[model samples]
Target: MAPTLPFRDINVHASPSHYAFSSPSSPSSPTLVVDRPSGDLRLHDGKLLGTQRVSSIAGILGIIKLRLDKYIIVITKAQPMGRLKGHMIYKVIATEFLPLRERPLHDPDEDTYLSLIKTLLKTGPMYFSYSFDLTNSFQRQAESDTSAPLWKRTDDRFFWNRFVQTDLIDFRTGGGNAHGFRQSLGQQPGMDPYILPVMFGMLEIKNTSIKGKPLTFVLITRRSRHRAGTRYFSRGIDEYGHVSNFNETEQAIILNDDSSSGLGGFAGDLGYQNGKIGGAAAQERQVLSYVQTRGSVPVYWAEVNTLKYTPTLQIRGVESATQAAKLHFDEQIRLYGDNWLVNLVNQKGRERRVKEAYEQLVKSLVSAPTEDTEADRVTREKFHIVEPERQKHELDRLHYIYFDFHNETKGLRWHRAQLLMEQLREPILQHGYFRGVDPPAVATESKSGTDRRLW
Candidate 1:
């Protein structure tokens, strides 16, 4: 099924009874109404009734309750970031909160809560797409079930509006039956016209041509909502194994191939059949994506800030740290296969303690003998298999490399950085990037012994 484009230009009509939202471009489009009395959402026949004020909004973000009043968050201004897979992406440039009640209660706590919300929205980076799932990478989207709606397919870790959009999601699933509404407005239950999922992170897209072949380079960094806070206030892994400031960055290249263009050289030699764009028989677009992630050390640790230039680092709970690291690596392996942990910290200094702790933690997981003692055996078995053979397998998959970046790069000797790259060359080659194309063409190229190496 084709994805439905969300309404970009929405006309919001505020009345004494309810607030009506309708698309200004489409007169026949169904209008979503939110009753002020009970805060119930229902569908209208694209007709404005008792409209006191009319305003144009980019899109509805969601609804949030601040003490005694509920406010509707709307995107006041948005700028186009770029397009991915033929879907236009937008970054929220500005936002406004419209109170549901005409005269909201003036509570001190409510004011504080509203101020916090405003500060968060103002400071945080948010991006969204009408039809594309911004929370997921291109490779993930290609593997996901396309039949699902964009809202449902979004990654929960980056879904910034998940908490506020609960009502809309519930309304979609309930089919508006409780409010005596039955019409779907020609949209599936999974797709809601009034619902927009926002992702919190960075998105950059550059359109350029290589050898006269047009292509788009996109960089997307998605931040996890879990354990997220200020640098000093939030550090280390939580009991649930969620690390602070966890983020996944994906670099993707999108190429639209056309046979008529007669593009030759770099673009023409992509190993497609007959040296053609897609294949000799079929012309198609190509997308290549590579994803990497960063997070705080998955251990029980903290850095206390005491109004000093450098904070005091403390490593806590060795037993709990082991358990947390295990959970963290397990999840990483499940998502991205083998993990190459490259730790770059000072070898001797305040940061030395952290580096040593991390190294010891890794050694314990990958080398410690299972028959040390009953307590030791029990602790290892509690987290996962820690037998010698199992530990050996884990050691092979989980590689640890520590490099003193500051010491090596001293005096602007950047050439020394190549030493680190040499160590990572093997693992990088083993785990190739994700590229979407015909399987038969790829197999044919492989059989022909062609060298299609990527750097």
Candidate 2:
């Protein structure tokens, strides 16, 4: 079923451009100031106030957590739009806010209001910015929590401004520039916000009790941010040839209440010390990870190079297409491992040949690496073609994903059918190289479910 999102569903929207920040004049009068084109923002309060030069366009978005108290969220960068190499360019954006109260009550409506405010801001010409995250203080506090890994702060690459200072904003009246508006107001450090892709909406879930087991159906929709724009108006292919509006809708089912375990340590750690000693400990925490990916498979094609809305599938050559497809699956195998399911959305009889080619390609690529003979065999054995008859049961595991490339529903913003094709792909966060390290040795889990040495 198409999942319905809550009012707080996280979707990316262009932020408002007009709002700016200024020093607070009085206890009652707060002022807003816009930065000039010269990229200068001054802190006006005393004690090193008017000292720092903030070379970014930013402004206050609004006050959140209003039910408990008002916390002002400020966008530090003003007007994210700028030009690069004579072509319009957009980069990541930064944001920081000060909380008013020492301890504000947790308001559930905060997410909903935040989404609404961002949506309203998108009505104007605002693009060319990546994401906004709170400054350093909140990040330290967020990373301090061990119980909630999901809430833990990730690496700085994901943050637009990872090096922002504490005294960037000069707070008047309440306290010095180093502290927030008031030092006694019980202000906490900042936490970076997860800039959910504009393609996906807020988190949604359904609860049910099947037999005696508690079950949860969670749906996460991921839309591609690359070259994503209005219907027909924006080009479908990016400069790098990646397609636009490729959405990956993930449906995950949990048999019980358990947090998803993660690989401990930094982002690009190969089989590092996760506190657990052997493969058995890791296997014990596996938690039935059954996932499927259905999206525009890696095919060497582009649409933006031509004037037509849906440019012809510019297949460079048969060999190039195969190479692209191979690179795509190579990354997938590394990230998801060999066991996850693959469903290439069959497009009538037109894609039959492509499907056959892809199937053969996966088989050839999966088994080809003679450098690691045992690993190659294991990879080949792990991936198997799903039989048509049991396709439903194969999908009816702890996770189920349905991918549809409905040409009718998605009219050809490209073709005669004004239909737009959305491919349900895995999050790009899943696929990143663990740089400066050799491929770690494979550790096979034992059938006895005991500890097996990973490295």
Candidate 3:
């Protein structure tokens, strides 16, 4: 029940001496803003006014503006897995009661406030922050019971942490029959425990549209057969019409696996569609469709596995074309080099042939044509070199999200990797033996004498 401090980024590094977070295996603190008291204007007779005071409004508005400026607008009504409902409203609201924190101060007036001013000058004018010690609840409780050392003159130096109810987003399952168990590695309790999650890591993203409106996009993640219980991810619109946000505290307590097919039952067709997983094929689809459907909201993709381990699945939306194209080329090239250019007795043999063809392509600077079976015996005199297909300059946006795998939501996405493996294993290569150098360097044809690469 202790308060949480400014959260540390999951990827950040810290040495023991400077690090603040003490424990992790322990559950995270509830992140809601609770215990809010409506501020009232007191009458001369000590009567309470019906509304909050002007100062309270200013304080809340100040914090809201600060948050808006500091963080891009993510208008969240759906709490992520590790968060509580209403966590956002309460966090900004709680900052109101504390007077110790202030906006930029004007010139200090007195010698008495000089030390405070000097301390601010030496350290920082920013708000002082802290988190509750989660390791020792009793120690924190005992410490809260005691008064501060006779050091500070103002109660404003202290801050109280906040929390919300333990509500979670339930990602409903697609019926009792999921493809997870069928395509899984055969084992009751088999496979490395770590790699097991990889089975459930597959996810997809799709374009969404309402009848007359422009195409709106959403990122969807799936959670199936959770161990703790069911999670309901059914859609509902509150008084406000956001499709995914659920505001009614009165939601029926059915698990994500609610059997009653009522208010919240199951995920519809979006569950079983074909999309790239983490391999090379996935990269191609993700980048291609993303660029194809430019200028729309980006939704992160996720899903749960019904496999040996039902770890949560996640695939983030791509941001830029340059990045996307780069990632796309890198992954596809890997597949082409290692999987496509081969011929052998078995699957392994096919893989070896692909590797050989890839080496030939890079070394001889030419691709073997798939038109005939005698491509392997092709001589240097018969080689034909061609430039990569060029997309328009604007299409280079594909290079953004497609460029870097690190920028991809889930780390080490291999969506197309497996498919590329299969493709490279195929015993086909493109080349030309019946040729002449009398042809033009660039092929072109028109009404006049338009002939170019005919060379």
Candidate 4:
């Protein structure tokens, strides 16, 4: 196959354009990377990696950093339905993981790690726009220390693991863009020339009717670009312990006075919420509540086969399932504090074991008396099952394998979103509401280009 130069046709309008390599779409062949001015194409080994036709390509999703190397992530557009208006209408059907270089560490765990990461890439449910810069925008919010130009980056904490992974990946993958980012580290950086990831579902509630105080709460969830396939197709855990689905979920609350609170230019204030709109005194008084959670493929073992109308199921064992549940709850406590309400949905059939295991684990944590009376009391009061009376307090689910992006995941998310809304509804309706108000700006800045609205 003939290797192609990435972004060769587009005018980067710079000499000595920095280049990075993507993993090969297939195991047998190497793909190409480019130097803008010279128009030279080569592989990580300094061999010339070639490219195919532009019509055959969709776009690059920005380079990803792996443990030892960097890979150019490509989204290929497929035109199975044929062409229109002299153009081939394409959809991003597949991703190509082209490696930039050979693995450096020869550890026994390296192979397993690579396979797990690949599984994440192949399985991740990603839809790309030939126009939007999903990679750079995500990195800026998640990895970049400096802010972007058109859209302001949200709080780094809003996309916690997403930022962690990208930063580590950038460090491990070596330098492509970071080389340039380093020079402007201390100095005030220019606005980023990238677009934020597209958000599918957004909730905006205007709370003016109930009380004299008028406030708005906006919630947006940016789906992880790294998504796996539907829940039914993928199976088992890879070496790294990541299961089928992995993605970041961001939740933000926007509040403003009635006068300045129209969607027309309201997002401009989001930048102020980054806790950096003014000096130290101003930052300290800001009151913004942004929280992020994650949903991934279950760590337990299960397989699905299309041959049968319904896939055969297996529980694998109780030990691993228990451990996975323990680790998950532990992390939640560590991040969000010990106050949690464990909700175990009972069901018949295979899920019975999984649900039972989770319930038992929660019971163990709450029932086990510790030496510290205060600690024991907190555990007992804060953790409990979701009974019919306390439905308002429930906010999250403990599903081992949440089929994110599928119909099943959607229903689950909607259910949770409703629960959250219910928690807020009763209080707002009862008293209109009164509290300390120092809400942060909820603006979004992006690189100057064809802009898209995520609201």
Q: Each candidate: what lDDT?
A: 0.70, 0.31, 0.19, 0.34
- Candidate 2 matches the true fold with a TM-score of 0.36
How are the candidates ranked when ordered by lDDT, highest leading?
1, 4, 2, 3
Task: Give one digit per residue, the lDDT tens place, for model 3 in 120-231.
Answer: 3233211111121111111112223222211111121011111000000000011111222322222211111101010011122223334532221222111211111213
Deviation in angstroms for 196 in model 1? 1.4
TM-score of predicted structure 4: 0.40
Once all C-alphas are superposed, what RMSD does model 2 give against the true structure?
17.9
Instruction: Please provide, for model 4 over 52-81, each residue's C-alpha lDDT reduced to its tens digit, 9 standing for 90 to 100.
Output: 323233444444555555554555533232
The candidate 4 region of ten consecutive residues with least summed lDDT is 446-455
Q: Which ranges in model 1 have alpha carbons more than 4 Å from their true place?
A: 25-30, 45-48, 104-109, 175-191, 257-283, 367-396, 438-455
As for model 4, its CA RMSD to the true structure in angstroms is 14.5
**Clash tally, candidates in order:** 0, 27, 77, 40
Please give me the total number of clashing residue pairs in predicted model 4: 40
Candidate 1 lDDT trough over 10 residues, lowest sum: 446-455
Model 4 score (lDDT): 0.34
TM-score, candidate number 1: 0.80
